[model samples]
Target: VAGLPNNFVFAQTGTYTFTMVTDPNNQFAECNENNNTLVRHITVTNLPDMRILSQHIAPSKLNPEPGEPITMNVSYENIGQSNINQQMKLKLLIDNIPVDSVYPVNGLVTGGTTTVAIPASWSSSLVGIHVIRAIIDADDVVNEGNETNNEATRSFVVGSSANLFFNQFFASNNIPAPGDTIILTARIGNNGDLATEADVSFYYLNDQLDTLLIGTSAIAVPANDSITLTFPWKVINNSTVLAARITNASELEFTYDDNRATTLIGGPPQVTVVSAAACTGTDGGSMTAVVTGGKPPYTFSWSNNASSQTVNGAAGSYSVTVTDILNRTATASGVIADSNCCPPCTKAPKKPSLLISGMSSTGATNKFCPGDTIIVSVKIPDPTACSYSWTVPPGTVLLGGQGTDSIVLALDGNFAATSNIYASAINTCGTSAIGTGKLNRGAKPGTPGSITGIQDGLCDVSGVTYVIPTIGGLVYNWYFDTVNTATGAGIITSGQGTGMVTADFTSAWVKGVIHVTASNACGTSGARKMTNLKPAPGKPAGITGPSQVTAYQAGVQYSI
Candidate 1:
C-alpha cells in the first residue's frame, strides 16, 4: 500500500510495488535465481474528503417543557486526517435569520467528533417551524502542508414546548374535615410546540389572606395533547379555606398565560344537633341530632342541668356526652351550631331524640377454638323487634342459623364467630345500627393417636372383620384389603363406627392387611397395620383308635 499524493491539482495518484515469481525451469539461466515468476500489481488513488467538523446551538437545548429554556444539540465529525482545533459557536435561527443570542462551544477532536449542548432563551413567537444552525471554525490553521481551516454547519428545527390548559375549575366543598384528603383534578392541554411538565399545587388561606402552600406535583403532558392532573391535599385540623392552582414549568420560566388556572375553595356544610334523648342520665341513652347545611367545623353543646355527662366533639351519628356543661336552671336543654359562629345564630334542637342506649352479650367469651361450641346472646330494648345474624370467620362453617341474631357456633381449626344484631323500634321509622360480637378460636393441637391391631387374611377367605378399640371422644376410620388371585390392594369399608369401628371385606383372602386410624379434637393418630389371617375351614375329618384299625384291616384283607 502507498499513501496518496497530498497536493495534486489534477487527479492525485500514488505508486504501489509489484512482485513477480517464476519457476526455475521457465526462467532464463542468466536471470536472477532469487526472483519469482508470478506477477502482481497494486495502485492507490487520492480523493478530496469533506465531513462535518463540529456542530452546536446558541442556547442549550435540554428537557425544557415549553417556552422555557431553548434547546440545541451541537455535533462534529472528522473531515480529514489533520486534527481540528477551534472555538465552535451555535445560533438559533428562524427562517434562515439568526436568532437574538449566541452560545459558545469548546472541545477538541483528534479523529472523530461529538455533539455538545447549547443553551438559549426559548421564544414564544417562533411557534410552528424554526431552524437552528451550529457554526464551527478552526480560526488559526494557516500552514501549507497542514489541513485548511475547516467549518461545519448543521441545522435543526425547534419544537414547541408543552403547555397546560383547563376548561373549568371548581371545588366540591371548601371546608374539609381534619385528617381528610381532598383530591383536585385539573384538565390540562399541551399548546406549545413540544411536550411540557405540568405541576399542580394546593394552597390554603390563613386568617390574614396569605396563601399557605399545601402540595405540589410534576405531571407529563404531550405536545398538542390534553390530560388531567390529580393532586391530593391533606386537611389539617386548623385549616379553614383551601384553594388550588396549576402551572406548567416548561422551557425555563413558568407559563401562566394559556396554561395556569385556579379554583375557589369553600368550607364543609354545617351540621345541627336536632336533639339527643338525654345528655345526662343514670343509664346510657342515645343522643339524636339533625345536621343542618353549613361549612364543617361546627361545634355542639348540650345542657341537662347535671355535670356528669360528656359529648363527642365531631359530627357523627352519635356523640358520647359524659358531662353536662349547663347547670340546673329549672330547664335542661342543649345547643348545637358552627364552632366559629356565636350562639342563637346557630340552630339548636328543641326536644330529645329517641336512641337505643345499650346492647351487649354475656353467654360466650369473644373467642373460641375449633370444634368447640359457643353460645352467644345479646341484650337490647325489651319492646324492640330484634334479629340476629352470625358471620363465621374464614376457614369455618356455621352448622345452622346462618342469619340469626343469636346462635351456637362450633369452632373448627383457627376460626372465629361474629354475630351482628339488628334491632328496630316496634313503630320507629329507622332501624338501629348493628352491634357485633366476635369469637376467636386459637390454634389446634397435632393429630390424635394412631389406629392399632390390623390383620391380613389368606386368599379364598371370604371376609375379615376386626373390632376397633373404644377411644373416648376420639373418632376412628378403618381401611381393609382383600386378596384377589395373587395381588392385594386396600378397599374402603362401610359401617365404620366412630368409637368401635369394624371393617369387612367382600372376599376372603390370604395375605391381607387392615389399617385403623383414630382421631381426636387435636389431630389424627398414626395408623396401625395387621397382617396374616387364618385360612377358612373346609370339610371335617374323623380319627380311629389303633385296635379298631387292626380289626378292620384283618376283615378287609380277606375280601380285598
Candidate 2:
C-alpha cells in the first residue's frame, strides 16, 4: 500500500513523511509466527524546486495552414537540494485540462533540461492567446533523507504569422536551345523570428516561355534578409511568349510560405497561315499566308494562290506572307490538308463452300479388327481454282495424304473408331465453313460353337458317353434327356471335350438321352444326340445231373 492519501493535494512547500503498512490479514505461519505484522516508512515533501526556465512558441501566433509543424521548447531545471531520479514530464493543457503529453515522465535525472515539440495542428485556430501550460512532475527522489516532491508549471503564448514569404528560390533549364535562353531571378526573406530552410522550384508555365539555362545555384537567405538571385534561360521552337514561376516553398517550425510569382520571357515572331486547301486527284494542293511580329490587327495576302485549288482538298506544302498587328510582315510556309486515298477497290473472289461427298474405309469390305489398320477417304467438292485444307480426328495415324481430303487411320483398342474430315476452300476472300464426314468401324458379334456326343444312363453304372464339339473359336453346351417324369428333364453336365467322352451312372436301371450344342461368336451350331440303356440279365437253368448223382443219399432229389 502507498503511504500517501489517494486525493491528497499539497499547497505549501514543506517536508511530509508517510508510512506504508503491510496487510495485517496476511501472516507467516512458520517464521516469526507470533509477530507477523510488517510496516515501512516513506516521506513526501511539497516543494517548488522545478520550473520552466525558457520557452519559445514559434511565430508567437497561430496560422491556419494545412500540414505545418509547430515546435515549442520548454527548457526546465531541477533546483532541489537532493538529486531527483524521477523524469521531468511535460503536459500541454489547453484550458487547465490535459490534452496530450508532449514529453512523458521517465528516466530523467536531476539538474537536467529537455525540449518538447508541439505540432502546428495543436494550435490551428486564428490568432489568439493559446494558454499552453508546461507541467513538470518530480515523481522520484534518490536520497532517502530528503523527503520532497518537486513540481513546476509555466505558460506561453502562440502568435500568428499568416503573411507569406520566400525562403530560398532558384531557376534552371537542364538543356537550353539556341537563341532561347531566359534570365530568371528569385528573392528569399522571412517575416517571422523562426529560422527556416526551403526549396524554391521553377517551372515553365507557358510553352512560349524562354527555356531555363543550366548551372543555376539555389540561393539561401537568412531570416529577415532578402537575396536577389538571377540565372539565364533558353527559348526553343516558335513560341510567341514564355513564362516562369516559383513552384514550391517551405519553412521550419514557424510557418510555410507558398508564395509564387511568374514572369513572361521572350519568344519568336508571329507566324500565320492565311489560306489552305487540298487539291483533286492529279491536281496539286496549295496554301498561302503572311508572317507577323509585334501583335494585333495584322493583314495577310498570298501570291499566285488559286481559290479553286484551295476549295478542293489537296495534299502538299504551300507558303504565304502575313502582316502583324504592328504592321510587320513575313513569309510563312505550311502544308495543305490532304485527303487520304484508300487503296483501289478490288472485289475479293468468293470462297468456295466445303461440300462432303462421301466417306469410306479403305480396308477390304470395310471390315477391321480392334487393332487393325483402316484407311478413310473423304471426297471434297471440286471448287475450281480454290485452295482446300483437310482435318481429321486426333489419334488418327495418317499413313498418307494429309492436307488433302483423304487420310488413313489405324484403329485403336476402343470399341469404335471414327474419322472426321474437315474440308475448307479458300480464294481471294475468306475461307469457307468446314465440312466433316464420320467413318465408323464395324462391330462383330460373339457366338457359341458346337456341342457333340451327349449320352446318359442310370446312376452308379457305366453308360454311354457323349462328346461336345466346338469350333476353334467357339464355346459349347451339354444337356441330358431323362425318362423319369417325377424328376426334372434336361440335366446339364460338366465336360468340355472335342473328340473323347466318358460317363458314369448312379443307378443301374435308369435310362436317358443326352444332347449337346456348340456355338461361336457369329452363330450357334446344330445340336447332337446320344442314347443310353440298362439291359435285363438272363435267368439261370436248374441244376440237373449233378444234383441227381448226389440225391441217392438225399432220397428225394427233387430240384434242389
Candidate 3:
C-alpha cells in the first residue's frame, strides 16, 4: 500500500491493520527474533453523513391566504458511521434568503433521524408563487458525509382572503317612548375570496341574553362584498342603550375590532299618586291615585279589597295604588274622616233603639205554664250598635243569655197569674228607652210537691183531714192505700178534686200510702206518692189492778 492516493476512501468502513517487518530478509541480526515485526491498527470511516429526507409546507402543496402564518418542516438523518457531537443549524429560507433558523440534529448519534419546523408569516402584499427552502448545516459547519445533500426546497402560492366584519350600525330613532316599536339595521363587509355566512346579533346594553333577546340575523356575502341586515326592537320603559355585534363567521377574518358597535337609547316610564279623601261618621270616604307618564291600560287596587279607583267604608285611614301596563306603580294615603279613628269612632255611635219583639210561646192569651222555660228576644234598629239587658220578675230565674239581645227564664211557682218582663239597650252614649211585655202564667199545675199536714187518727180513722200542697192554678185528685181504706185505691175522698184529702182508714195500725194527681188546661200531671200513713197507736189497754194500788206521796213507796 505505498503511495496511496490523497483522496482515498474506505470501500467499507471498518478496522484495518498495517504491519512493518524491520528485518524480513535477515539483512540485520537482532537480539530476539520475535521482536523483528511492528504492527498498528486504525479504524477507517466516512465523515458525519447527513441527508435531507423530506421538505414540507404545513397544509402541504396548497395555496394559503396572504397574511396567514405558515409552517416549514424538513426531515433529515445521520447515515454515516460517525456520530455528530455538535449542535447543527437547520435554516429556513424564502427565495434563497435566510428567514429562520432551528437546531434540528443536536448531538445526533449514528443512523439517527430528526425533523425541524419553522413558522413564518407572509405579508398581505404577497400575491405569487414563493420558494421556501430548508437547509441542514448550511454553513458547512458540521463535517457531514455528503455536503451537497444538506438543503431541501418546496414551492407554494399565496391566494386571496375573505374577512367578515361589521361596517355600519344604526337605529331608526334615538328617542323612543314606552311601548314604542322601532327598527335597527346593521351592515357587514366580506373582504375575501369566497362567500361566507356570519351572525349579526342585537343586544340591550344592560340586559341578559335570555331576558332581552333582540334576535340574531344570519347573512351570506360574496367575496369583497357587503350586506345590510335589519331587525325589529320594541321600546321598553327605562331602556338606555343598545348594541350590535357580528359573531360566528364561517371563514377566516383579517380583523375583529370592527365587528361590534353600540348606540344610545333614551326614554323611561313615570308614576305618581294624586289625592285621598277623609272619612265621615260611620261611612268611609274614598282615595284616588293619578298615573301620568307610563303605558296604559292603567289598573287600580285599594287596600280595602276594592278593585275600583276609589275606596270607601268605616271611619279611618285609607290607601290606594295605581299601576300601568308597564308595571309602574304609585301609592297614596290619607285619613277618611278628621274625627273618625278606628274602633270607637271620634263621636260615639248612636245608642240602639230596642223593642220587645215576642216570647217563645205567646198565643192569644199570652200565657205560659209554671215550670216552663221561655226565651224572650228583643228587637233593636241596629243590633250591633249597643248591648242589651233583660229584667224578669223577682221570682223568675234567668237561665241563660242574660245581657244579650235575647234572654231565657224559668217559670217557677213565684209567677202569679200575670207578670211583666222588661228590656233595654245600652251603649257608651246612653241607655235606650224601656221596652216591656206581659206574661200570664197558665192553669197547668205541675206535679203535687208535697203534703204539708198529716196526722194519725187519734179519735178515729174516719173524718181525718190531710192538707196537700201543690203548684197553684191546678186541681188535684188524691189516692189512698186499699189496705187502710174500705174503698179501692185512687178513690177521691172528701177533699177530692182539691189539694186536700179526708179519708177513713178501717185497717187498725197499718201503714197507708197516699198519692195525688194534678190536672190543668195543659194536661194531667204524673201522680205524686206519699207514704208512712198510720192510724194513731191503738188506745193503750186499760190497766186494772195496777190502778188499785196506791202509796202515800211523802213517806211510803209500794211496788205491785
Candidate 4:
C-alpha cells in the first residue's frame, strides 16, 4: 500500500519509503522503512530557445537524376526556458534561395524535439553542385533566446558522376579452332570523377544469341581510367559469340548503353564419328568416320595410323581423329570389348536405383514410425533379366519381394534404431551396384513431466491454475476426477489441448486428483496423475457482534 496509488488505507504506520525487492535465499523477505514524510520541488525557465537540431534529405544520393522528387525532414528542438504552442514558419532553401518560403511548423514542448516537413518535393535540376538548407523560425516568430542555430545546410551534386562502360573487347584467337584455348579480354572504362566497384560478366553465346553466363570477376574501376579483365575461354562451335558486360552499375551512372559489348569467334570445321565393337569370329574391332558437314572427302588418322574411312584393331579402346580438306580437325574415341563379351549379345546390368516408400528416403528421418510398413524398390535397365537380394536394418522383418526389384519391410516396433536397407540387382553376367534406402524408428510422444500447482487447493474455488512442462507438438488434455471418484474435483474451465489449465473445484470435493495426457499423430502418452489433492476445510464461520455500544464512549464493551 505504500507505493500503490489510490490505496490510502494503512494498518500500522511508522515510516515508509519504497525500494526494489528481490528473492533473498529464494524464500523469505519483508519490506520495511522509517520516514514520516517526503518533499519535492519543481521549477522551469521562462524564455524559449529554439533551434534546428538536425535535418536529413530522403533518397540520399550523390547525383540524383534531374526531375527526381526528393523530400527533406527537419528536426527542430525547444531547448529553452518555456514551451511554444503557436504555429511557426520553417523555410526550405536551395543554394540559399527559398523554394518554400513559409512551410508551417507545429510548436514543440519545453526541452522537447519534433520534426516537421515541407509540403512540396524539390527536384534536383540545373546540373551543378547545389546547397540544401532547412531554416526554422527564419522570420523571428518564436522570439527565441539564441538565434544563431536556427538553420542547417547540406551539399549535393547534380553534375559529373561515376560512369562506367565497356571500352572494347579483344581476344587472342578471333578465328579459333573449336576447343582451342582463347585469351579473352574485356576492357572497362570510367568517364567521370567518381570511382566504382563493379562486376564484369562474361558469356558464351551462339549465332542465335542464346547465352550461357560463364563467370564474373570483381573489378575496381578508377575514375578516368581503363582496366582490362582477362579470362581463358574456348569456343564450343563455329560462329560462337563471346560477350562481356558491366553489371550492377552505380545509380550515379550517366548512361547504360555502352556497358556491354560482344565479339564473335570463327570456329574451325570438324567431323562426327562412329565405331563398332569386336565380334566373336571377325576382325577384332573397327573405327569409322565420314564428313557430314563442311568440306567433303574427309581423312581419318587412327591411333595406329590406319588412315582411312574405317580402321580395325584388337579388343581394346581406340582414339579417332579426323581432318577435313581445310585441315580443321575433330577428336573422338571408342571402346571395343573382347569378342567373347557376350554369347547372346548382351551387357551386364548397370547400377540400379533404389527408393523407400516410392521415393528416396533421407537417412534416419522421423517421418516414418515404428511398426510402419515400408516399400523398398529398385530400377534397372532390364528388370526381366535381373534378380534382387535385400538386406535391412537389424531387428526389422522383411515381408516379401526379396528376389525381385522391390521388397516390403516391417519396421521393428520394440526398438528404435537407425540403419540403411540395401538391395542388389543380380544378372547372369554380373552384379550391379548396391542400392540403398534408410529408416528411423519413430514412436508416440514420451510420458510427460510432473504436473505442478497448489497441492491442497481450496474447495469450491474457481479458476485455479495448473501447468506441466511443455512438450512442443504434443496436445495435452486435462481432467479432474479422472480416477472416477464421485466428486474428486470439478470441471476444467479452459486451457484444454495445451500444457496449462484452469479449473473450478466442486464445493464438496475432497481427496481429488488432476489427470493429464499428451498425444500426437503417433499416439497418446500414458496419463500423468496429480494425486493426494484435497481442499482445505471451508473457513470457520465469522463471529457476530452483540448489542451496539454508545457512540463517543471510551472502552465500551460489546458481547458476541
Winning candidate number (TM-score): 4
Q: Which digits, one per residue and each the tens of the lDDT, describe model 4 over residues 1-560? A: 12321233322212444443444344544454323234433222234677764333332454566767766666778887454545678888888887785546666777787766666667766876677888877766554556688887766667677778887797888777778888888788898778888888888764344688868888988889988889887667544557888888653565555788887666445555566776432344666764554333456777866677777755567777876544567887776665543333255565667766721121134456555667877644344234566787876688766556677777555434567877666666666677777665555677789998876756778878899998655678797774434554576655667788887787777776788998754568888998877788534566566456677867754443
Greater TM-score among 2 and 4 belongs to 4
Task: List the candidates' TM-scores in order.
Answer: 0.21, 0.21, 0.23, 0.26
Cα error of candidate 1 at position 166, Å:
70
- Model 4 root mean square deviation, Cα atoms: 26.7
The best-first sequence of candidates by TM-score reads 4, 3, 1, 2
Model 2, 428-506: lDDT tens digits are 4445666655545543323333334423324454434555433342345555554632354232222332333444444
Q: Per-residue lDDT tens digits of candidate 1, residues 1-560?
A: 12122222322234555454446476467556655545545434321122333233333532233365555555655443333433334333545555443334443443566665544444553443344444443332212112342434333234444445675555544555666777766676666566767577777665444678877878777777777666676665333444555564655322344444565444233333343232221122334434333322223444432222244222223432221111111222343232221112122212112221211111133434455655554443323222233345564555543323334555566543443322222112223444454444332222334344334333333223455556444456665553532343333333343534433333444455566666545455676655553344433455433433554355432211
User: What's the residue-level lDDT of 536 in candidate 4?
Assistant: 80
Q: 1 or 4: which has the higher lDDT?
A: 4
In every candidate, how many clashes are there? Answer: 95, 57, 9, 1
lDDT of 3 by residue, 114-213 (tens): 7665655444347656777777776556655467777666666577545677787778886777678888887888876768888888877433222355
> Candidate 2 — which residues are off by over 4 angstroms?
1-182, 202-216, 222-225, 232-258, 272-560
Query: Which of candidates 1 and 3 reaches a greater lDDT?
Result: 3
Q: What is the C-alpha lDDT of each candidate?
A: 0.43, 0.43, 0.62, 0.66
**Rank ordering of all candidates by lDDT, starting from the highest:** 4, 3, 2, 1
